[model samples]
Target: MDQKQVRQRIEEIIDNNAIGILSTVENNKPYARYMTFLNKDKTMYTPTSRETYKVEEIDKNSNVHVLLGYQGEGFGDEYVEVTGTASIRDDKELIEDLWTDELDNWFDGKDDPKLIFLEIKPEYVRLMNGRGEPPHSLDL
Candidate 1:
């Protein structure tokens, strides 16, 4: 696939998958957790509490990986492997934009001080197990 096609495929994957496993590194080891992933265009965001290990890990090492598109149910399914840099963003305006009542299940409301978003800016995105056997790299 060409770059545009690959980019579209990735956008579709992220749009179809609501939750994804995000991996962050700590002391060269990987720590991963399921997160409520959100998107704006091609960029992805995941909400997290301030007093969390993931936030600390992001602080230490910004590089992270996100596995999207696969729902953890079947084998040989399609997914997107995203390699990116992450930062803990305390942007209330962005929070208000992505806020949903479903997320209220986690925080004390959108205004909660503990609420924050992990901003992931993808540097390299790989399309896996979709369309063709060849892995396609999509530019960010």
Candidate 2:
């Protein structure tokens, strides 16, 4: 697939599965967890608590990975493998902009001091293990 086709597929997958596994480097090892994510333009956003271990991990190593679009069982399941740089932010404007009532289940509303967002800026992405001939590389 070409870059444009891959981009559209990536967006489609992201729209289908808002949840993905976010991997962070911790002590030179990978620690991953399911996270609810959002996208605007081409940037990926995930809300997290400042107190979480991933915050420290991201601080130590900005490089991160996210696996999205996998839902059903087993082989050839469609997904996007995202490799990016991550940064933790406490911007109130951004928090408000990305906030949703569903998130209140974890946070004490938008102004909660612990409320923060992890911004993942993708460097490379791939449409992996799908119904295709080979993995398709994508750039954003």
Candidate 3:
């Protein structure tokens, strides 16, 4: 596929998938956890508490990796690998836009003091198992 087509496909994958693994560097070691992600354009957002370890890790090192889009049905499952920088965001507009009822499981509500969002801006993105083609990078 051409660059534009490939980008659209990748964005489709991002939009279709809600769960992913978010990896952060902690104590010079890799720490990974499952996170529910939301994408706007090509950027990804995952909400979390301000006091969480991942937030602390991102504060020290902005670099992060995300594994998303895989639906574990069979050998040909497609997935996206993301290399990016993460930052904390608490903008009221963004919070309102990305808010979901499921997040109530974590925070008291959108107004909760602990509520925060991690915004990931991709420096690199790769699409794997792309309809029998070899894995390739998507230029940002």
Candidate 1 stretches greater than 4 Å from native:
72-76
The residue-by-residue lDDT of candidate 1 on 1-140, one tens digit each, is 79988888888889989889999999999999998899886678998899999999999999999998886556557899999999888887999988889888889999999999999999998999864468889865
Q: Write the per-residue lDDT of candidate 3 for residues 40-88, one digit (tens) a residue.
A: 8778999999999999999999999999988887666889899999999
| Best candidate (score: TM-score) | 2
Query: lDDT of each structure?
Result: 0.88, 0.90, 0.91
Q: Considering TM-score, which of the candidate structures 1 and 3 is the better prediction for this target?
A: 3
- lDDT (Cα) of model 1: 0.88
Query: Per-residue lDDT of 4-81 in model 2, one digit per residue for the tens?
Result: 888888889988889999999888899999999899878899999999999999999999999999877668788999
Q: How does residue 130 of candidate 2 score in lDDT?
A: 71
For candidate 3, the 10 contiguous residues with the lowest summed lDDT are 1-10
Cα deviation at 7, candidate 3, in Å, is: 0.8
- On lDDT, the candidate that comes out on top is 3
Predicted structure 2, TM vs. truth = 0.95
* Pairs with steric clashes in candidate 3: none
